[model samples]
Target: MRPLAILGDNITTDHLSPSNAILASSAAGEYLTKMGVPEEDFNSYATHRGDHLTAQRATFANPKLFNEMVKENGQIKQGSLARIEPEGKVTRMWEAIETYMNRKQPLIVIAGADYGQGSSRDWAAKGVRLAGVEAIVAEGFERIHRTNLVGMGVLPLEFKPGVNRHSLALDGTELFDVVGEIKPGADLALVVTRQNGEKLDVAVTCRLDTADEVHVYQAGGVLQRFAQDFLAQ
Candidate 1:
């Protein structure tokens, strides 16, 4: 899977799904305008989240986002921005997600310690899963958010001690594959293939943490697991 976004420590739910005013220039705001909604009526994302069209655009919509993949003069560029791989085009986070979605590409996010550390919001997990993020490999995770990710069928893998995105020198120009079986706290291999064809196998700890969580994740999330059981009954 490709790295959709490489983020740093303390990436809160607010960063994943912003609750602030939607500016007219944002992807969600632009979408609302196309739908003929008056700029004055363009509400906060939290208010219009029931509409997937608007909500999906809010993924990584925080203006304060600092995406490592997006850089300007060797400094990490801030804002809700991302770099489309291979092409290396830097665009708003939603535009990049839209492009990958249209391509039907599976994505992954690489993050630092305390990833998803804030108010527990379902939208934080839902938004990434909807964007085709199959997994997230981070230095560490917030407890509630980690469970939420499992509920959404997104694998949460933790780096082994002293191993992190920075140590690996990941510049978002690489592809990743999860090698080996997954189970609670199992060591899984994260196969990193650089743009120049170099490969490295790094071990990551599966954060499933419980047999029940594994069952739910393997069944493709909470709703799917419920449906499967219901039909079986």
Candidate 2:
């Protein structure tokens, strides 16, 4: 892949996607706290995203609520690296996604094993796709998340065993090239090229393991494919 953006090693899908409990808290805690979501019944972050008031708050508020290995004001950094509006608010991954979405910038996520391993929810892929992620690359994958990605029409790629982001220094800016038609178990080439002109060529497997998957991805998503078929009849 030419112009491939690289990312660091050991990123899981959960790290890429927020958990329901955390998502619930992140979704509602901000505004609700001010309007009084009642700390007791504030609910999980995943539960209240349907409510814009809660979702907006949770989106930004969450970067301050979780432990992302770095702490400020007693809150760990959780979201993406954001320039945080107002000149200085907490910056986190979710907030970064929120910012990128607002800017209409296309995104790509890179990670390592058990990627997308925890849950089987379609929201995991939908959330990222909605946030404008065009594709994802990882060292390995969890079965369900891999399918969910294809179902959402997001590309899921697995790096060959011996090569990963660590060796490539992928950090979300390197562009990737997935050359050749993607097919199940086919060895696809991922050419990672840094902005400064350094490059690393690696081989990865196409996560879409079936003919049906290729069809689904080509059609945009499972639901879209289904709708198209339904309309055809």
Candidate 3:
């Protein structure tokens, strides 16, 4: 898997799925306009989130997002922006997701401490899973959001203490592979292959935390697990 977006500490659910007004030029706004919704009728993202089409566009849609891969003159460019690897094309976050979806690419997010902070938003986890994010490796995670991610079937891996994206010098330019049997609190290897053909294996702790969470994840999420249990009864 490749890094879809490299982020820092304190990334909140609001940043993952902004509740603020959607601008006319944003991916969600343009989609609404195409569906013939009047510009004035384009409601806040929180209101339209029942529709996955609109809500998915809100993934990483926060205007204050500072995606580390999106840089200008050595400074991180702030906005809902992302860089498409190999091609290195910078585009709106939703558009990048569209491109990856079109390519059928599996993605991963590399982040720092306190990932998924703030009010618990289900869509924050749902959106990334729908975007084909298979795993997230972070320095740490907020308790509730970590559970949310597991419920959504997105693997949450925590970095060993004192080790992080910065220490590894991950610039969202490398390919990553998670190697090891996954279980609650299991230590796994994150194999990072660099552009120069160099490889590094870093240790990460799987954050499933409970046997039930492992079962839910293995079933492809909470809802799927529930359906399976009901059918087997």
Candidate 4:
């Protein structure tokens, strides 16, 4: 996996999936319009989350998102923007996700402090997984969101004390290797190799804080585990 995007601190659940009024220019709104839903009928993302088609479009749909990859005239532009690595195309967040999905690429999101600090919602976890994100390495994580990620089978890792995205010098131009085994409260190594052959190992803590969380993650999320158990019985 590689760094899909580098995000800042305090990235809340709403940033991952906005629940406010949907605007015509928003991804969810545009998707609804294309599906023949009238402008006035388009609802908030929180309402249509049951429908994955419309909900997935809301991934990273936050208008206030500040993706470092998006640049204009040598300045970091705001909004739901993403920079596709290697090819280096700066485009809308969803478009970049679409490209990665089509390429069958795996993704890893690197974030700053208090990652996933807002409302507790599974869509925040589901949306990123649907985008093909395999894991996330952040400076820190909100407690519940960490569990939610595990429930969704999305690996949640944390940078060791005093370490962060900036300290790693990750510029979204590297391949990441999550090296080591999975265990509750385990310290893992995130091997990052840069484009110039520079490599470094960053120590990260596994966010599967409990044994049950580990089991759930191993079974590919809560529902999958339940299904497996049910079939066995």
Superposed by TM-score, candidate 2 places the C-alpha of residue 79 at a distance from the truth, in angstroms, of: 6.0
How many Å off is the CA of 180 in candidate 1? 1.0
- Weakest 10 consecutive residues of candidate 2 by summed lDDT: 60-69
Candidate 1 on 46-94: residue-level lDDT in tens? 9987898998889999999999999999999989999998899999898
Candidate 2 lDDT, 1-233, residue by residue in tens: 21112334444444444444533344345457677556777666567656644444332232322322234575534444443322334445456656666766666666666766665655567666766677787787778778888888988888787876677654444556678686776788877777677877788888888989988988988999999899999
Clashes within 3 Å, all models in order:
0, 30, 0, 0
Q: Model 1 TM-score?
A: 0.98
Better of 3 and 4 by lDDT: 3
Clashing pairs in 1: none
TM match of model 3 to true structure? 0.98
* lDDT of candidate 4 over 7-64, digit per residue (tens): 9899999988888888988777888889999988886788897899988988888888
Count of clashes in candidate 4: 0
Off by over 4 Å in 3: none
lDDT of 2 at 218: 80
Please give the CA lDDT of all the candidate structures.
0.94, 0.61, 0.94, 0.88
